[model samples]
Structures are given as structure tokens and as C-alpha cells.
Target: MKSKFFIKGVISILLIFLSMYLIDVFVTIPNNVSIKVNEIKYSFKGKIIEKFAVRNTEPTHLKVLIKYDSIITISPNPDLVDVAAVGDSLYKPANENYIFLSSNGNIKKFFYTKLSYETRSNKNFPREWRNKWLDSSMWDSSKEIN
Candidate 1:
């Protein structure tokens, strides 16, 4: 009887983790956003999953969220590291160095992240870091905004 209860408990925990996994796999701020770079324009739709957020999506509206580590393996040229509009703020890439992004929400979620090439398992996430609440994309700089 005790073993039965133990198995049930383990299964419950696994299920919870699995649910979180599914949310990460199927959700992100719908592609209603993008970035424009002179001659290029990038866009992601506005997507929201009631209780979850992708690192590229809005975490504020999520209950179980997964963020990933984005490390800029190739430093964008300072000249190419242009400006972006994040909500009301204009974001600029580090241009010289790179930063890291982790699929976590504890404390790393609060730290500011730079525009780095998400690698390894962090692929397919938005290219830049911006709250998806603004209905915008971090990597939407493909067209001439100027």
C-alpha cells in the first residue's frame, strides 16, 4: 500500500514537470512582433499561454516558464549592433562583448540580458531580450526603420 502511494506521488511530480515542458515546447509570444534593421524587418506574433512563458515570450503572464541561455558566439559588429525599441525604451546590443540567457525565472529572470546568439538548446527563441507584453520582437530588426 505504501509503495502504491509512493509511486503515485512520483508520478504526480513527473506530470507537473511534464506539463511545464509541454508549455515551453508549444508556447511563446505569438509572432506579432519583430525588429527592423535598415533594410531588413523581423517579426514574431503575439502569443501567450495562460500559465507559461518562453524566454522569447512574456513571463509575467506565465505560471511555469522556461528561459534558455543565449550566448553571443559571434559578436555583432558595433556598427551593425543597431538600436531597437523595447516597449518605450530603445535597446542597443552590447556590440563589444556578449551576455548569457538561462531558461530560469528565479533570479536570472530579473537580470538584463544582451542580444546574443542563443545556442545549444536555446535555439528557436527570440533573438533579442524584451518583454513580450509590448507585442514586440527582440530580433525584428530586418527592415529599414530609419
Candidate 2:
């Protein structure tokens, strides 16, 4: 009798944990990222003076140092790190969550909302979209607005 109860308890606990994991992966994280995308809007426009990776961090943080009106740093997506080159123009509008990169007269726009939605729907979206999002070959200056 005692063994039966113990087995049931363990099964119940396992089911609870599985449900929690499902909710976290499917709902919680995605909603949080979407909220952050809508809430946090940083405005900066400048030339990328430097790009470096902080190797000391757990997942090495890639950073872009910009200068124009004042100095500021941006930790963009890993894909952006490669697309953006030193001397390229970087613009983040105050009203939106778009990161625009203009390189040699060609421009690429990265929308945080789309990234968040992609992350919510597919776990491998980032890796799959890597190099595709900001590839220099796909850059178009006229199509992208400042």
C-alpha cells in the first residue's frame, strides 16, 4: 500500500515538472521577450567605431562601440556582429525596436519583434536565420528607411 502511494507521488511530481517546463518554453519566455521588445526603446545613431567580444562572460558577449553625439555601446544579436563593420552606420530609432545597419551605402534592418516571434515559435530559428538576416549580399539602401 505504502509503495503504491510513493509511486503515485513521484509520478505526480514528474508530471508537475514537465508541465512547468512546457509552460516556460512555450509561454513565459516568449511573452517576456515580447514585452521587453515593446517596452525598451533605445535611440542612438552613430558610426560603429569598434566591435569586440567579451570572452570572460559565459556566452561571450559581442559588443559594438559607437560614437557620434555621445559614446554608447550595443550588444546586438550574434548575426549583427558580423554584418556590422567598423565605419558602418548604426541607427536605432527612439520610437522603435529596429536596428538598422548601413554599410557602404547598403542597409539592412533587423526587427526585434520578428526575432522574438521567431524565438517563440521555433527554438532553432536563430541558428537557421543566422547570416541570412543581415547578409551583405541582401543589403539594399533604397528599400530600407533611416
Clashes of each: 32, 0
What digit string (tens of lDDT, one per residue) describes model 1 on residues 1-146? 99999999999999999998888667742231221121022211111123322447533222111222321122222222122111111122232122122222211112122232222014333344322212122444442221
Those runs of model 1 whose alpha carbons end farther than 4 Å from true positions after fitting are 29-114, 119-122, 125-146
Error of model 1, residue 142, in angstroms = 23
Instruction: Report the alpha-carbon TM-score of model 2 versus the true structure.
Output: 0.46
Inter-residue clash pairs, candidate 2: none
Candidate 2, 40: how far from true, in Å? 3.6
Candidate 2 off by > 4 Å: 1-39, 56-69, 112-146
RMSD, one per candidate, in order: 18.3, 9.2
Residue 84 local lDDT, model 1: 14
- lDDT for predicted candidate 1 compared with the true structure: 0.29
